[model samples]
Target: MVRKKREKDQEIGGFLKSIEKIGNKLPHPAMLFVLLSVIVIVISHFVAKNGASVTYFDAKAKEEVTKSAVSLLNKDGLFYIFNSATTNFTGFAPLGTVLVAMIGVGVAEWTGLFNASLKKLLINANPRYLTPIVVFAGIISNIASDAGYVVVVPIGAIIFAMAGRHPLAGIAAAFAGVSGGFSANLVIGTTDPLLTGITNQALLASGIDMQLAPTCNWYFLAVSTIFLTIVGTLVTDKIVEPNLGKYTGHYKSDDSELSELENKGLKKALIGLIVYVIIMSFLMFPKNAAFRSFQEDIGKNTLKEFLDNGLIPAILLLFLIPGLIYGKTTGKIKSSHDLVEAMTEAMKSMGGYMILSFFASQFIAYFGKTNLGVLVSYNGAKFLDAIGLKGLPLIILFILLSAFLNLFMGSASAKWAIMAPIFVPMMSNLGLSPALTQVAYRIGDSATNIITPLMSYFPMIVVFLKKYDEESGLGTLISMMLPYSIFFLIFWTILMAFWMFFKLPLGPGVPIFM
Candidate 1:
């Protein structure tokens, strides 16, 4: 029996090795984006020349609309390509957010606060629960938008390295939680309202006379938060870590005990962090909170607006203050010049990611300009509609379709806007609730996030991996993450099926069947 298990493991290793080899053969990340951009240009021209178009329900327009591919080979297209190059690079979503977040994290790292705190945490944290804790943190981070990718993922690596484990495994585990479990959260997050808006629009356009709530999937996702944590932890321990074999990279596990000064710094840092949290609480929780939206549409004192807009700066301050406190306590940051140098070093590390983001931004921008994503999504939905599938098979296929489309499109709300009008009503006709359809979409949308380069944060993750292993390439990252993706999709689908079979409520007062 042991021999058989060994054989199976070898086979899996061989398969992953092949994937790594093939993926690494592709161009460097920057060049790959350039190549993909060119491909999108060529394809858009060809499709436009043939006059390919699709008619689908537009939730925003509240009417059926025809979308045709815009050819980037045309004069107008060339003008746009040239005119938007600067903005494309500048307006890239992840670039600014990551750089800003790193400024604070950089201070923490430079002051040795991270190292000290990690060492103390290593001694205090139970080895048995560390993986689950990291995974759980990743899951919970969804409430703060992209905070997980920028903060939780790299910290995950540090935590593992401190524990004398593979840092890559740590990254994978956290990424799996942050991206793979994106739709599963204990609290209502920005995604809820974003998706619920589209769902209700779909219902309205279809004349259903029923509106879905933002918390439509809350109950199920809350449960899934725990479910995915267990699954992610198991996959990390049983499959991902073992496949990685052992940590043999530039990062060595630091088992050194913290000195008295370091201990004092950590205590000071903790106090600083608590103080920061309390201040933020006062600003956020009050009826007339400082960060609240006073906009007529969103209403006054809305915490959601703060979460969406103010959280990043708050995070920056969160780390910056604690780091400064820790640095002062340890005499590592003696002056203003030291603080500037720490932030400068952090930005220095991000130089390579910025270059990659420029090309990636163009590729993403070009793809959107060409309207290929919309065209493909509309056609895919139409194909699914024509297939006349029902019951479990239909639900499973919708999940698969959403997962497939996720490879090409990164925005969850955007994709749902295009798909909801079609599937929500189609499923309604088949007696499934729109909430159930949205649940299926979320499952598919999340499972593939780690593997897709188009995802805004993908380049940042590459940079993180390179810090530990300079030789790590797209293939290396993909091969590492594919297991998590596959297992997540498989088990998440099964969980959905289980919910369906049991006739469980998807959320508060939201049933699986209409």
Candidate 2:
């Protein structure tokens, strides 16, 4: 029986190895986006020349609209390409939020606030609950933006090693929650506003007058955070930990107690955070307040405006102020120069993301301009309508499709920019809510993040694992994570189904069905 199990594991290893190899052969993410942009251009011209167009009912316009290909291979298109290059990169949706949030995060990180706080957190944590704590922390780290990947994931390994457990299991658990649970969080994160912006844009492009709230999926995400935390803990303790066996690496745990200055810094940072929250609430909750109003449209007043227009900067300040306070208290920032350096380092890391965004932005813009997304979605909706696949089953298929697409594209925002315009309208037409489609996309995107080689952080995860197990590679990382990914997908989907059955809202004013 042991031999049979070994043979099965061998087979799985071989399969994952093959998958990694094939995935490695794909072009870099930026190049792939350029290639996709070129494909959209070619397809645009081809469709234009062939005079192919689709007539679909425009829900917002309350009329049948003819959607035709708009080729980007001509003089006018060339002008747009040239003139829009700078704006495309600058205006790429996720770029700004990531940059702004990371500034504060980078300061906190450089100042040793996060490190001190993390060490302090696990200093006295119960041995048995360590995995759950790590997993839950990973889920909550979403509120701090990408800090989860940069801090929590690696710290999980160190914490596990301190507890004499398999560090790789800790890494797996953290990565699963951080990436696989990326979209779900208890609090609004940079991603929430980022995605909502894109979703709202797609809605407008599709001529819908509806506004998508940043909190539209908040309730569902909070529930998902709890669910993923539990599942991640179980998988880490049972599946991933057992598979990894034990820690045999030479990496020592830095269990040094938090120093007086570090404790002081944390307390100062906490005070800053609490005060910031109070200020924001005062601005938002009071009648006719700075961030609230009585006369604005429902979901459009001061609070909504604050969320829609002010959320990104508000989050930036929230992190920046606390981080600054911590840095000053910890003596990490002797002057303004130190703060600037911290911001510079943060921006430095995002250089690669910016390059990728340049190409991805163009691809997204051209695809939208050329009407490819619209036509494809129209045809796709027609096919689904013809086949009578509406409701829950269709939603499940959309989730699977998103999951499959995620294997090739690592950038969540890029994938969603393309997919949302297609699926959102299509789902809306199918008597499903656009928010429902977005939720499905989020589910599919998260479930496979840990297992995909093409995921931006997949290599980083392997690096973390290799610190403990030199034999760790893409195959090893994927193999251990495969169970977590599978379980997350199954359980998350089941939860969503249950929610749909109960007619529960996915978020504030966001329903499952139209």
Candidate 3:
């Protein structure tokens, strides 16, 4: 048995090493993006000269439009590219969000608050439950776009390291939950409306009078959240973590052991947290408050508005206030200058990310400007429409196709826009409801996110993983996340198939068949 186990371990290690070797052969991530941008520019010029164009329904515009390639090689294109370089880097979603969140994170880390508080909690808790907790948090963190990648992912690694486990395994688990199980949130996320709006537009354009509710797939989304949490937990414990072998990073476990003064500082931080929460409640709960009066949210879904607008600042403050008190109490910060220095130190760590963002932002911008992603998705959907696959097989194929395409296309709404117009109408004609189609799309869209290097947060995750393993690269991430992606895609497809078999309502009064 020992020999067999050793053989198995060797086999797994060999396979992973091979994958890493291939992945590492690729250029550095920043250069990879730079090369991709140049490729897009070349492809765009060729396609434009060839008059290659595609006409599809645009959900946002509520019309059918021809999408033609735009080459960045042209004078106008070159000028626009040059002009937008600063904006592209600055507007990169993860860039600003990560920097902002890290200000608080930096102070907390510098003062030893995160170490002390987490140490106190984990020291008393059972270590077995850590995987599920991280996974569950990742799933729920979907509501705050980019925040999970910036915050939960790194925190998961830190927590795991503190618990004497492989930090990369924790990072994988968190990224899976945050991206792989993205569509499965207990509460509706911004994705619900964005996707539903496209589905509804597709239905209307197809001459169907019915419209989809934002929560059309609520039942499936909520159930998948629970199942994914369970699956993610098991994969981390049984597959990913064991495969990681063990933690051998420089982040010392003894660093988390709280000193007496640090514990006292933690107590003060807790009190500050309580006061902050109480103040927030007075502002958020009351009908009339200075905070509420300043903002305008006509959509009645105050929760969405609050989460979308208020959550980040709330997260910033949640960390900042507690961090300030902790640092002062711990003697880590003697004055305002110390706090400023801490924030600067945090920004310093992100120097690598800032460079990565420049090339990545350019690639994303060039791709969008060329309409390459949209054209590919639209053409693929048209091909799928040409073939008349029906029933469960069709749904399975659709989910699988979505998962496959996700590796190339990262934007959920952009892919949905191209697919929805074609699939929603196509599926509805076969007696499957638009809600069912949307649910299948969601399942596929989410499951592959963790494994894709093209994802915007991909570089951010690499940066996080590098903190634990200096040489960790694209192959490392892909191999680590592949199991969760495959498990999620297959299991989610099966769950949706089961849901369809029962002829159940997808949400309140949202049936599977028209």
Candidate 4:
């Protein structure tokens, strides 16, 4: 009977593996997005020609589609496609944030600053506590753009392997922190302003007189940082790490010794980074500084104007200055040619992403033009509001809906761009804060990033996995991350519920509800 059971398990595993093989051969995520968007656009045109209408509930009221395909194809609707496409393709779009942020990141990566620092930090840190520390650091690293994805994740896998644990477990833990904890960082990053800008636009669309501050969720995120770190650590060790059992593969850990020059270079980079930050802070925040972006006024404060206008440049400089200093100190970049080469190397790595982004931008723009995203979000929000759901049930439903939508639409901002206009207003009508609604949306959006193959990083992770086990592919990666996803979803949901029950502030100057 025992032999028969073992044979049966083997047969099941084989069958599953065959299915995954077929799935992995499908078109890349970018191609898939483009194809789907084209289909939606074509179908929408036909539907408009036929004057097809879809019914949806909103603001606890019933709504029916009144516009036709031709109507949607007009200048106002068509303009959105071109406009959104431009935004998506440019550095302002959701995809652009990662790519643009990577410019600085790639430089730092090329300069060996991150690699050298991680080796030194991990070597000195306690192994038993290293897992959670790495995960927490990954979450914090989001302020530095794609640094978390490129630096922390791969290093995490290496760290785990060195500690005599499964390397995949390290990847999962780091992924949970980097991707899953994306919206839960303690410090506000570039994404905060981006998301807030969209949220403010949505609020204005609803005729609300409000300013959605970028750091609105900072306090809540700080608390969540601790919560997620604990959860990531526990899940990695108790659930993910144990399941992989012993490492049977011949995956050698990174043992390359850091050169003396590299060590000195890192010290110089750190010192340079500090000096750059101090100079920037003085320029941006000093009371009597001439660098203030706006005149002090009752309505427009100097700090506010600076935050609105100068943050992007600050973000760019944060990476560029440190990176250049590191490169120069390490002798990796002594001349203008070396500097240009560093930037070129960065762009070269982005070839795959650029291809993906082109398609993703087209799809998102086309979908927005067709009003499919708006239609879906409006109807979904209406239905939930009509049901009069509140508290945990409302948040749980939102999480599932966001996760479902995430599979088809990988861009978080695009999805939020559509959903926020409808959901924020609908929830506000039901006496909930738009900030709280945004928080719930963020929670749902982030939890599934690790498991979703549509995510741009998903393919890169699969490539990483392939290095460890040749048979490892998309299915292997997704299956390994599935536990983390499910666990994070439950844990985060519960934490949100607890926060709501206690009526805790979601962030700085942001209430949990109205």
Return the TM-score for each candidate structure.
0.98, 0.69, 0.94, 0.72
Per residue, candidate 4 scores C-alpha lDDT tens digits across 1-514 of 9999777756644554554566566565556666676677767777666764444322212222242233335566566656766566664244444555667766776777766776777676677797798789778877755557766776688778766678877887888898888888877876777677677776766777777787777777788889989988887776566656678778865558888998888888889889988887787667766566454423342555555454555665677778888789888888988877877887786676666667766665565556565555545655665776866687789877887677656677767766776678777777777888887888888888888755766756665565566666666666667766777788888888888888888777788777
- Reference-based lDDT, each prediction: 0.90, 0.75, 0.86, 0.70
Error of 4 at 373 (Å): 1.4
| Top model number, lDDT | 1
- Tens digit of per-residue lDDT, candidate 1, span 1-514: 9999999988888888788789889989889999999999999999999998888787866678888999999999999999999999999988888988999999999998888888886797777687999999999999999899999999999998888888988999999999989999999998998898888999998888788888999988999999999999998898788887777898876688888888888888899899889989988888887877675644555777777767888889988999999999999899999999999999999999999999999999999889999888888888999999898899999999999999988889889989999999999999999999999999999999889988888888888889998878888889988988998899999999999999999989999999
What TM-score, to 2 decimals, does candidate 3 have? 0.94
Candidate 1 — which residues are off by over 4 angstroms? 61-64, 295-300
Write one digit per residue (lDDT tens) for candidate 2, span 317-339. 77688788988987888999999
For candidate 2, report its TM-score.
Answer: 0.69
Question: Compared with the true structure, what per-residue lDDT tens digits does model 3 show for residues 1-514?
Answer: 9999889877876776778778878888889888888888888888878877898878767888898877778997899789999998888877777888898888888777887888898887788999999999999988876588878999999889888889999899999999999999898888898789888888888799999888899988999999999999988997788877867777776643667888889889999999999998887767664355333423342455565666677788889899999999888999999999989999999998889989999888888888777777787777778888999999998998898888778999889888888898889989999999999998999999988767898989988888889888888898888889989988898899889899888998999998
Worst 10 residues of 1 by lDDT: 292-301
Span of ten consecutive residues with least summed lDDT in model 2: 293-302
Winner on lDDT between 3 and 4 is 3
Instruction: Write the number of the candidate with greater TM-score, choosing between 2 and 4.
Output: 4
